[model samples]
Target: MAKIAFILLCHKDPDAVIKQAQSLTAVGDYMAIHFDARAPKAAYDRIRKALADNPNVAFAKRRVKCGWGEWSLVQATLNAVETAVEAFPRASHFYMLSGDCMAIKSAEYAHAFLDQRDVDYIESFDYFHSDWIKTGWKEERLIYRHWFNERTQKKRFYAMFNLQKRLGMTREIPGDLEVMIGSQWWCLRRRTVEWILEFCRTRPDVLRFFRTTWIPDETFFQTLVRHLVPEHEIESRALTFLMFTDYGMPVVFYNDHYDLLLAQDFLFARKISPEARELKRRLGVLYASEGARFQISNEGQSLFRFLTGKGRIGRRFAPRFWEAESSLGRERELLIVLCKKWHVAKRLTARIRALTNIPCIEYLFNEAGCDLPDLGGIQSSMSKRHRHRRALMRMLFEYYDTERLVICLDPQNLDLLEDFCRDRSVSRLLEIECQFTDAYLGGHAMRVGLAGERTPKETLNRLLPTIRNDIVHESDRIRDAQFDNHLRIREIDPPDVNARALAAFLSLPEDIARELANTDHLFAD
Candidate 1:
């Protein structure tokens, strides 16, 4: 049997924190918690009281003022890990977890699983070579000193970087240090944890160097572990299922993810939102069983069927939808405009609206027709930007009563959109390539009714092929007659006829007009 010490970093939702602690402690494992110093005293007190009776649980003596992408996050982890080690020196494994993380497997299963592997389960990748961050951003993250918390001073820093680039000023990582960046969550051997703590104590310079690094929590441990442990001894997969949005925000898990969670081999899932009560309950029930193998729920079975091509959409459409966009505020208007000016975008949007009435499109239609959104009010503060978008997404999700959404985009938007999706955290949206069947038709237009998820392969492949084929084929034909033929089978207005009077649709401000026009028509006909 493996004795594990869980080091948890909790910042919010005291109830969820208490439950997670209890769940772990119930397994007879030791846990040490570090509540964010910035969190309210009442929240911390509540959590402390909840775990006060558990002898297996301990609290960090010194709490850190945790902030996103700040050294404080790394410090918090260090504090908790140190506390756990002190409380349970005989523990064989130390798992670093977030407040929202929940174990999907029983303690016995986790221990048995770990017993089979001598390697440390830690996520690490070379900063320069990894696609985890944007292609060229590894340099900016590792080279330049990130002085301020990204949530607050990101825009100003970006502007400063741009100015530095113009002035030919550059920074480089120290030659002796190899930069490694990856997910912060990990399960490491006690020896590895001890080595990291020792390194922090003896080599204060490592901590100092990382203090100025962006999201140091991600890179600090990874860089240190890479130096301390042999390459083969470290496992790249953390065994924590964290789904990131297209915008790089961690997707909030909900009841709908219940089936998906059952299917994953991951032992834990992180950053669960407050809304996931049923998911929490289901997970609790799942862990009640001693065996690792559990029956999948009917909903899970249905979802798996849908994902594997037993449903309307085929397997060619990836279950992971990547919404690639360059800017924050372009999507809604872009989709609406495309629907009006282009035939394919319009038909797709119409069909989606008719079938699901997804709130995002409906909200956009209502707002776009009335008045343009005040994009100027969106501040440069990274926190404010995300809060604004999240609010909008929340409203869309709440009003629609569905998590599934279509990210209307074009080929040009792919890379940026992908970056944006990961940045924003759009985990629940269905993954499918968006494309038009025909060329852009001006105001004199036809509403070509496109086939839903059931169109023939020859035609559907021509219009919206799998993302793999879309990238390779690179055909420039603005219209696929085969796809148009399928659409024609459904009642489509004649090419010369225009059903929608889009003359009153809102126009873009001068600054962003060029961006809209420059968008590639490559994805569609």
Candidate 2:
């Protein structure tokens, strides 16, 4: 027995208005749509013509010239309410909405919910006592009435307001009714709405006073509903989910905010961005679905959180915020293939690609003169490689999603070893050790190396041991990390890469594992 009559106050985007009208359609339900009179005649005609076939759709016969913070906005809404009330006498409730509003939940959910609740869903906080009015004239709006629109004729409007202020001229509200204020959107029980209309009918002096009052749409019904319905019968909030900027403009929902919107318990959301076609398309489907339910309120969540992503965010490990670093890069697709010799690495890469079709790239860190043992250049080279590797995982995931590729690292370069060892994208590591060559100095140790930083003999004797120790330390750190530690050591030493190590490293099929073991011959001298 709970049926809704939707009263839509719309201005722009006739196509969107048509869609909004379509969404309001249900058995025994009605829609009374009103477009701004000053809006283009062509758009208004289009909306009417499109809905001509829908018997449930009705439109306001008289268009009202609505403006921001103007009385005509209230008149436009009143026009819709009058049309809906007269046309659909059986409609149990009247829900006011705008063209830009969208249903966040399924229609069935809304019906089932409204069937159980006869209370009027509106916010009617006592205007003077509540903190609802922020950064605007409160009692002043009603006490001084002006016809000039604050938006369209701002200079004249403010000048008149200032003149009235200086003259100390004010008018009293027509009655002793306490002013109540809240959001303009609401869903009222049919009786409550009828009472409001009756109140307006008998109170001609009050209606005349509101004809020029600043933003009467917000206060008129809000005050009337509070008086007609007891405090317990009125739910002090609207059915529509609305958010505002610091300047009181409605926060427009975009495509990226679908999850945040879906998390809200409210039936509908207001002020969807015009460009959010994908979001509209998605929500259009959701409106018809029966099982969709939004039980939580996501008002406390920051906008950036939804803008950034819809999924899990935080550290690489089982991310509870307090214990780990705050990071969002979680596109960890592949285990690492660390090898010094490109030829051996190439063979391994080919074998993996052949078996799993997982693409692999090699010789990344070894490129920028990193083979030199100059300590200063080593630091500089690490910085450059870090810069290069920063977006590497994200790009790989973008190009080749979950079933993607591998990163080949040079184990000889301590920078590559250190960076990839702790990298979140690198799941685990398999180091293919080949014959260690002094080929940089033609099988001989030089007294002086690149940039005159360190000789080959000096590096081999002093730095090599420390570098080895550093690699061990990093590997140990990775294996023994408190969380998200995916380092598994499967050393594929050439000429002796057994089946056990291959099985330990890759979870590939049996035949692929055998083929990977056979790739050890590529490292043979």
Candidate 3:
């Protein structure tokens, strides 16, 4: 029987780590946890005390202060491996994991599967020949010494690297090593583990070279395995389900990703969000007994790619309904109501809410946060900013939820309006030419809120000519039957949108809008 030893490198979330260990421990695998040295002593103690009764569980002999993209992580891994090797003498293989990682399949199934394979499972490719690195510090990482955390201590880290570059203090790949880089996670046999340890002992020069390299945890063991281990004895893939963004940050899985993950046949998945209780439950051994039996769908792959994909702009945005001028839900179907007055915005948003029974936002881009029905669908700190709005839009659509937004594109919202009109392929734009109250023209009403660079009146002054010309031209196109399905605009101007007139103007199917308009006040939430 092949027993597995797990090297767990944990820095945070002792509670989650406890739960994960309990699941794996239930299947009789031995585990060695290396809590980060810099982590709070209380957290480490908590994890240790919680798992104290498990004989198979042991803490590493040494805990090091680990940094992202630093050699300390590999050192921590070695610490955990040493402890596991000593604690579990019969262990035939070992795997690298983190506090965030959770076994997707049952540990017994994982052990059985790995027991049958003699090859080491790791993702590896020639660093010079491959484009595995999508962003930041490619060859420069190896050429220069990184003495600080690249992300947290970015300025100093880069300054030192730049200074080294200026001095021409460069080095080559150490020894006969074929430099390989890929995911940091791997499953190694005891033989391979001993090979790596022996190689480390004999190759102090190589160790020195990688210790200063950027994200050497990704290359150190990977390069060693490829250089020393036979090609056939290594499977150039990791068992862990992992993916990275353009900035090299792992995509954090949430409750909504339950189906997407269950479909992929991987032993474990990491970078799980702490809020993903539902996803954690669903991915547990109880839910995935047969070890992810579902086939990986092409749509799932596209959805994953959609996370890191570029934001569409101009004609590059291919929308089935409306141009979002956003990233998340660019092609999602949407309904946006636009008017000049607050009263108009309220009436439109309320009527739609009454019709859909979903309280839609009243003033989406208004500097002053206001919602008509204000059901609190999307509450944002910078609601007026483009990035925040785009993310909210994505959440609404991707959550299988409905959205009914009423944007009062009063002068203050010229930037948003400009982007919307520029898209041309609109999803749904409900336009109402409501005249401003005479009080505002006479400077009697309060100037309300101040937006960036200009007041509402001033913004209107800049937008009037372009909007007038475009609306007229588009209206003419509507008259000439040039109104395409994608640019779905419904323009209506009633002297007053009294309930009866508003319902008729809405033109909803089965006279639904009419009924809702009539009884809106009675049934309104």
Best by TM-score: 3
Residue-pair clash count for candidate 1: 24
For candidate 1, what is the TM-score?
0.58
* TM-score, prediction 3: 0.59
Q: Which ten residues in a row have the lowest lDDT in candidate 2?
A: 444-453
Poorest 10 consecutive residues by lDDT, candidate 1: 481-490
Q: Is candidate 2 or candidate 3 better by TM-score?
A: 3
Residue-wise C-alpha lDDT for candidate 2, range 265-351, written one tens digit per residue: 688998799999999989888877877656453432233322233223222434333314422145554567665455667787777
Q: Taking the tens digit of each residue's C-alpha lDDT, what string does model 3 give over 1-525?
A: 677788899898889999878777766777899999999999999999999999989998878999888999988998888788778888898989987887766655676779787999988999988999766668998878877998889999978988888899888776577799988889999889888888878988988898889989989889989988899999999888877765667888898766555445577888889999987877665533645344432233433553334222233234334334544443444455545455645665666765665436656566456532322545444543444555455554545454333344543343454445444224454544433333332231223211112224433343345334444443343335322222221223222234444443344553665454444332111
TM-score of each: 0.58, 0.58, 0.59
Q: Model 3 off-target regions past 4 Å?
A: 246-248, 285-299, 306-525
Q: Tens digit of lDDT per residue, candidate 1, span 38-147? A: 99999999998888989999999999888888888888898888898888977899998888888777777788889998989988898777787864466777666676
TM-score of 2: 0.58
